[model samples]
Target chain A: MARPARRGGGYWVYLIPSLVLFLVVIVVPFAMNVTTSFTRWSGVGTPTWVGLGNYAKLLRDERFWASFQHNVGLIVAMAVVPTIIGLVLAAALFDYIGRRFGTRTASALRAAYYLPQVLPVAVAGVVWGWMLHPSYGAVNQIFGLKVNWLGDSDIALATVMAVMVWFQLGYPVVIFMAGLQRADPALHEAAEIDGASWWRRFWHITIPQIRPEIFVVLLTCTIAALKVFGPIFVLTRGGPGSATMVPSYFSYLNFFQKADVGYGSAIATVLALIIVVVTFLFLRLQERDS
Target chain B: MRTLRAPGGPPGRWAVLAALVVLAVVMLFPFVIVTLNAIKSPAEYSSGGPLSLPQGVYLDGIVEFWQRVDFGRKLWNSFLISGTVALAAVVLSVLNAYAIGIGRVRGRLWILVFFLVANTLPQEALVYPLYYLAKQAGLYDSTLAVIVIFTVIQAAFGTYLLSAVLGQFPREILEAAALDGAGRWRTLWRIVVPISRPTLSVLVIFFFIWTWNEFFLPLIFLISNDNQTVPVALGVLQGDKMMDATMSSASALLGIVPAVAFFLIFQRTLTRGITVGAVK
Candidate 1:
């Protein structure tokens, strides 16, 4: 049944200010970035049209492909790996720890896990940099080892991925905890009464019950992984060689550092398109599932 | 509460508790280590173990970090930018949320969908064009440029949140106000804002923390040394060949202290904001 409508035709006026700024700052520039991607231009002078040239270069560019490879690695490292780890941690907190102790303790523990999410990436980078320093860093000396954490090309990306995983762990934990709240207790009880072990019940009942939250975590964290720039900017500056360069960093380097605005915009547009497409696909999948 | 049984009574429960404690320690230990090293001299840092206490209350790391990083200026700039964005963003969101939510404006559903998409456009996507625009406007190096960009970003989220809050406002109250000849703006300023204080506080707190921590836009826009926010300013401390592990440790501590303290203080509200925003 439809509710009675409020009396107003001028209500659109209230939305004007937010809409204007949003369009100018976000929508219009987004359109400009799309057009700029097609042209050849440095940051200065005037733009010259060279349709498809940048995209052609982008496709053939080894660094571009390598950056995508790193992004895929990041997907596994930051999004996929963390989701699995966070789920188990969250399940333990919800099913075992919190159930045994109390929610107060469980939520407190949740906050502790959430510490990394609160700090800015720059700050987290500094802390990690201090810890991962090659010579006198705490992590190396503590283990009585020497490793170039942010330098050596072979392992710097892996190191950065590890940090992103750490930063992302808490978000899913909290979201999953809350998702668990809405789960039906009956299913868990039924599984338990059938003499299932804790693992069995969690596998059959808990994961299935909170499937939507898993998707939520996956989609959000994956987008975050794609846009990861801050920590890289601080910790490694895309590193000793181009080891940790993701598309986001690649774009910034091309734009500000390399002064190839067209190429930079192309990289950014490609990355942004990927994020939007993946997000759209996930949302559609979610809609279909429900 | 007992729908799901604990597998075993005490032993199993204790193991789970121990595991959780370990997880918490793993999460929090980095902060503790950083704090311990912040006050140590570079010599103490190198010679002693990572966990060793400073021999003498040496504070050179923090002192050097303070003098070198333009610490006070960064804090002030962060404060000003975050405050301005929070205030302005909240007002814009409140007004927009009011029209679409309480006023039940036509095409309200479309407006909400528009913002949902707008919110996801990786803000980095716009940094270039914004850079170009700011340069043209002579706002390239100004804090105003950062403020203007961030306000729009935060305002998008704020609209969604405050809209939900406004939608819950009792109709009878608004009807009474309308009957009293109060106009829309008047009813809003007089009634809706006061009653929606809790949600507005949530929006403001979230915006304040987000803007203060915002790095990319400010990093690109605010190029001047003194104009950068806390995160971007502190970012320069890392990877400097001359800068030691001690200064990095100290800067890390300084960078996190404010956000962490704010979190602890308003944790109840902040936690609510997270869960609400998530489950929505």
Candidate 2:
């Protein structure tokens, strides 16, 4: 550690390349998003300054609100339901599987559960799209009924959410398993000695201990849900009267399909702010805990 | 086997096992369905229903799907793009992570904060401007666009992973390398890298899977068919006339093989990478 000055120089020097790339690819574009959202750019010619016109339009855009509602629906499907199920599954595995089978079985079970996460989003999208194809799709055949899984506007968002839940379920299960592993064994044994039932012990001991993991799962899943595109992009394509539309894909459509770059940028910028704000909120909670 | 404790405990364990098995089946449902459907002829898929066994194993759907998409080129394109980006990301991450993570530099914490925020920013926010930029630079519709975009994004994530690797380095080895009169570059290349190879492989795999799965950037930038990547090509095929249920199942199956195989092969390390990255 002789020449601390030169060492510092090397450190700062190494950050430059990645930083430059970050600034160019991320920072500059983000700044442009802020500016472009204020202008009417059709992505072909010069952008005209519009000054919050797009933002004003977005405030009243039914499709925008509908997509945002779908995002909320996605949150329920992708985050809340999966986290609940994942928690129960993880608890069951942690509390029971360890004693009954072994760590090997538990681990194998986790790997199996995480199988869907291994596949690319596009692959999942395509596979589910086929299975959910309203007419002759397998899902309907298997259910022994004619159900429009992806065609009915009323249920299309729900169907997409179901797929999102499936795609996202594995992530939380994995995280929760790890979190549950860190819980003190003696604490559980002590609770058991007090005649605590499985459900009660889990609620009192497991949930409180793994709150951080739950928060992490929730934040990640919520963000992922809010930003979901690939499955919707490939599955429904915002179909059945924009039923399954999400902010990310909606923004994509606005930019490319509608050729309304200014409005698209506005939608994206708002979504970006939501993510950042939520992230910061989570960070604050995490920091305060620490 | 002799009677003994199983895993988590004795009570309610069978129930947990049953539940896990159910969840596992749900998770593998798509894979099973795809595998069964992909080998079947389209007529069988429509007529025979979901649980119907293939009358004969007609592998021609996959064969035809392969040729129709000219998937060989797209496959090469995927490998080229993913390999190039993963390698670049790993290299850049090693250097950048060494600086902030191992160098004990001032503001290293702040630098990591910047990275955290950067990584959190969604691609939707950046793609529009990137589209405009790529067009002006004459890089639009080129594989270079996809490669560069993925490299930059993956490097941000890779930096976080590799930084953890550097953080876990044994100080003694680093000091020994320095005392042996090895320059920083030599120490990093020969000593630090050798020690961090496992973690580096984790980062590489992470980038490879992430880059291969990337869709939006290529969709926006690579407008032409020949330049499109696997996921983008697959995305286009989702809407194309030639694509059908059986054919797309074939495409989906083939597209996921490399990634899913990699996951199975490196499940331990990749799982550790994720849990360590997110939870820790």
Candidate 3:
């Protein structure tokens, strides 16, 4: 009796369900979106091919430029600031707390930090919206001030950024702390024995050991910053004069609110392109670093 | 294993611990305040201000918001959608990973990379077209539409992670399964899936939570009040500016309850899963 071949054509049969679903759900819709970008449509009738009209409109659209600019600031709040703070927090929790006090105490603190991450972003917005309401808000009540946190344009963006930092701080801390577990304790012991300062050991051993986790956190968080929508939708709706407008919310407004489907698709396409480029660049940097 | 002692003495360590405790309290302040105010009567809230403690517990805000939104229906819709997506996505992921990881199918690397890229494709890029397509298919305003979309989207990540995991699966076990005359499907169900159950469970939990928290696509697809998920219902209500402060706090508290419950229940698995995902 001959053994039947098991590894070739037979395996593709298992992939059939996933492949079909992928095509319908992701590939076809994404392709249609890109194709729709070159047309003018109100999303009801046939879309007329406008060539580069939408893209041209986007180029001069001040809102479009402002949205991208807001995204850059969000990158700092959601990614850069959080990563820095998270690194310090994770090191303290892992090295200082976990080692000296107990892992239980460290973990309990980690859970507290992670609590915010468990809420839906929209709910988080609601919570903050209530707390940051111009008149009767908790922040105002606590501080005895009358400042409008989400109403003033100059201050609105910063308010959103601060909230984002609160929302995002836990992620990097969790990831880096997990990564720390795999670090060779002997190296830390040796460094301590040699009288290496805590900061120096953190700079040398802790950071390098978890570089992969750091890269992963930064990449994911940056992408998340770019794609953020729910909080914007709930908190301000990209409002107070588009002060907190982001590319995703901008596209959403065009699609649903304005009924400018073609322009919306174009904005989304640009965002997708930027994300892909950023991801590629990050991966390349990672590969080179390794 | 023995705990390694830091160079800092007990006093310095206590200071660091104090700082961390303060940070943790600040991190949890929103939840603390929300819980505090959610039970306060609007009259009390107005008179005493946001910082003041309630003289009496108030269930009216919570009850009224729940009734106003028919929040039970929304919860069921979210549960139905996220639960279905989680199970279906896991099945889809296992099937795809079995092909690419175990079978080592032709051009597997390219296929894996495609899934990886697909995982990162912003939903904004896909949302409008999906909206259009869903409307065309007569699936608009339906939980099924949200369920289907999330199943595929979540599985992209699941397949990417699982492929890497299943790729390193023990070849001898598979060879033995084959030698025992188990067909491909049988081997998958009996051998591969059983062994990969932990990873699959992790994927299921993640997909469920992610789908439960989804807003944009669900907001688009589930336009009807009957079909809205918890996030969508609360979000639309918030947008409409119809809810009072106590009502909004009550709504926020309700929204936080399920998620926090899931987090507590799966804290260990989640912590372990995050490491697995990151290290892999």
Candidate 4:
């Protein structure tokens, strides 16, 4: 029932405008950044070739290292906590709400859960910063706790991580809920017939079914945690003496504020390399594991 | 078998529902606070917890806040930036995705993968470099320059998503159109566009919301008040009037109003975007 081959060159005509625009805007700029990273340019004058000087400086730079460490901390915290909490929340919701409510309510609830996602990160960061304000803010006032969220190095990173989690939880929860909805109900029914406990059924049936969702959630989240910026900017400005500085924030400060455009470009180039390599390795590892 | 009266079920369900309601309320409390506080007098805001409801709904605070922040002009700027960016991005992405999705281009998979890799790069890393290039081109502090970058950076991911959608679409439809002497442009304009409206609309909403709320881009690119978007404008307002809850809240409200309107308009599609086969 295969149709005969047809001849047409219309695709090329339609493709030209988009290709030119993307190449000039994205591809060219990206290549330029890579090239600029090896030079000593201060954003106003001619760029001088420095032959890996910027990369070497980045290697020994304590501030850059501090930012990397902060990102590592955030990635670990965000990756593990949100995935687990989101999964648990989905499980409880599916077990309880899925069986009782009609399809419309379930979807409405899902939308409610995802409201945070529509929020601009800047607004979320600002609102959260205000909420965690030390004196008359709701978080402090509600719990009668007087801790400064963005101050005091000990708690600054954690506070940022908490806000990140709050802002991020909705996406993963909805993802997990969708995964749960797609899982085979018969497996649960069989477990029910066998008189398995709710916890037991979840462990045996639900967890294994949604492994792919779990993996995707973890990967996307780890990458997002590494790239986090708006909250850091709005809340702490990578402050309390670099307590909350992440690689993105550090790179931004260096390139723009510090006027070390070459070094900043180099840091950014390295970050891009890290993301590509890490994601490649992760996909490879997942393929092998499966 | 368990029923509503089962030993550990009915009451437990109620408890869970109650907890969820509480969570929802807590989640929404900030909006309530920002709304009420923005409507209160400056003196009232300074005197009590920001979470406290005002004694009366006062327009004076909102009026003063609006004037101080230049809310109307900032909102118009934000609308212009975000609207243009989303529109241009959708056009570019739809075209790019169409090329790769339906065209006989070689290395299509590689192109898609390159876009994916580019999309994952930390945005902060590119901020300074882009700024440098813009300044070099004498486009600094210009609205068009920011819109160009926003549209471009966003187009990479937009292409990635739209291409994924296009790939899932059956090519037979396009092939059949071609068999009937319909050209690629005609086929895409007549056939592909109609089928892909759902995905395209979702993309539009996503881009609009993100572009509207974006701060880092505007912060670096827009150094002039005339170029500032709502979010950047609000940040400046906060800096200018430190600790003025009414002013800050009013700005926040203004920043969010457009987003809320967009969300309400496309609520169903937006929800579906987050859930429907999203993990893939």
DockQ of each: 0.55, 0.59, 0.69, 0.46
Q: Mind giving the per-residue lDDT tens digits that candidate 2 earns over A106-197? A: 78887778888887787788778777876656788789878888889888988888888888888888898888778788899899779899
Candidate 2 per-residue lDDT, tens place, B1-46, comes to: 2124344346655666786898889888888888888888988887
The predicted structure with the larger lDDT, 2 or 4, is 2
- Could you give candidate 1's per-residue lDDT for residues A1-290 as a string of tens digits? 12233465767788888878998899998989988998889988899999989999999999999889988988887789988988898898887777677888988899999999899878888889888989878889888989998999999998988888888889888888888888988888787778899888888888888889888889988888888888889888886778888899899999888988899889989888898899889989988988
Candidate 2 CAPRI level: medium
Better of 2 and 3 by DockQ: 3
- Candidate 2 residue A70 C-alpha distance from true site, Å: 1.1
- Residues B169-206, model 1: lDDT tens digits: 89999888878877777888999999998888888888
Please list all clashing residue pairs in model 4, or write none if there are none: none
Poorest stretch of ten by lDDT in candidate 4 chain B: B236-245
Question: What is the Cα-based TM-score of model 3?
Answer: 0.97
Q: Estimate each model's TM-score.
A: 0.94, 0.94, 0.97, 0.91
Strongest candidate by TM-score: 3
Candidate 2 lDDT score at position A135: 63
Off by over 4 Å in 4: A1-10, A101-112, A143-145, A285-290, B1-10, B46-48, B236-241
Q: Which pairs clash in the backbone of model 3?
A: none
* Candidate 3 docking classification: medium
Q: Is the docking of candidate 4 incorrect, acceptable, medium or high quality?
A: acceptable
Per-candidate iRMS values, in order, are: 3.7, 2.5, 2.0, 3.8
Ranking by DockQ: 3, 2, 1, 4
Clash statistics: count for each candidate: 0, 13, 0, 0
Residue B239, candidate 2: C-alpha displacement in angstroms: 5.4
Index of the highest-DockQ prediction: 3
